[model samples]
Target: MVAKGFTVDLNKPLVFQVGHLGEDYEEWVHQPIVSKEGPRFFESDFWEFLTRTVWWAIPVIWLPVVVWFISMSVKMGHTVPDIVFHSGLRHICVTLMEYSYIVSFSYQTKSYWGNTMHYLLHGCHHKHPMDGLRLVFPPAATAVLLVPFWNLIKLLATPSTAPALFGGGLLGYVMYDCTHYYLHHGQPKKEVAKSLKKYHLNHHFRIQNMGFGITSSFWDRVFGTLPPQGKDVKAR
Candidate 1:
């Protein structure tokens, strides 16, 4: 369980009530709150609990879904290479899709267009970097997203490919969530873990716009958003 911390009133939109100092709202939101659990979001006890997620829940709930979808393709006679290629492709595509919702606005408009949505999505994580529950995507939200994606895959691909493709997507999501949690909380002895933690943390603390890649920096390098080398990067 995430360590107990201050709770916010869920009845009101969150960003407006807290941390929106008279100064710029954009700047305040990115100033990491640095607590295991940041202020709570819901007024009701049940919803407040549901919003925070445990890191292990990502694999526990989703791995079975991945297996089920991949199994469908296997039953349809899809070969190992076919599944592997499609799975990796699905992973890459999922990462790319994240680029859509990530935008920075100089003007804070949380009251109407920008407020509650940003807090529920990206801004909350930036503000509450240490909130373990909010670190990974909630399974409930993922399930809702999966329905359309599953149908879209069916619409686009043959029976042989669609299941594996969707399965790969589920796998990628699990990996992404797990990796994100580790990047925040795990101790890294290996070079790869050390590197990924640094890359992701830098995104949170130092350079907000760059280093968008979480599990790997390949995307950042390809897109030219990778944090520059040879500069002093201090952890706050």
Candidate 2:
């Protein structure tokens, strides 16, 4: 039925029959969405398999590396004010730009490609929002995309300044993924987390196209997609 601008097939199963979790490489190839037991692959087969074991741990591993990178850059005579707000909060501004760009790009991709890319990038998670394994982008897949962004950031900003901005954006992605997982499975102890959980769940089952911002609702507010206020956003 036409709930949003797009038509959704209500009859289709939320978790489609792909294969049993981790049966074989052949079974997992190209399966974007999976059941609760899933660690599905997107376009790359070998890399996804290679990194399947470390998907959830990506934030854990990468965040500390980002910290180290930032720390080293600071030690190289670049102050936090110099690296972080070198051009008056330019670092965070660019980082926000990157974050918004990725969110919009993913949304546009899902909109253009329909179910296939949707399921691959995001729809599956919405379909099975509680599935722990599908919450974050596996490092293998993330690295494939980060290479180009790395080059772009280098060209866009100074060496001393770029890493700080890059690290900030990287941290944003990590927060988005981690916050996403927490929203689904975490019993949030804070009012803010509880509120965000309510907001994200609304995106999944109430307002599909709105509230795309996971880490921060700033963009959603700016872009006029912050989910209708005062409307009931009950969990699905």
- Cα RMSD (angstroms) for every candidate in the order listed: 5.3, 8.0
Model 1 error, position 77 (Å):
1.3
Q: Which regions of candidate 1 are displaced past 4 Å? A: 1-23, 98-111, 230-236
How many clashing pairs does model 1 include? Answer: 2
Per-residue lDDT of model 2, residues 73-126, tens digit only: 686678866665643354456446644644653433212334344455554565
Clash pairs, candidate 2, are: none
**Residue pairs in clash, model 1:** 53-133, 110-115
CA shift at 209, candidate 2, in angstroms? Answer: 1.5
lDDT of 2: 0.59
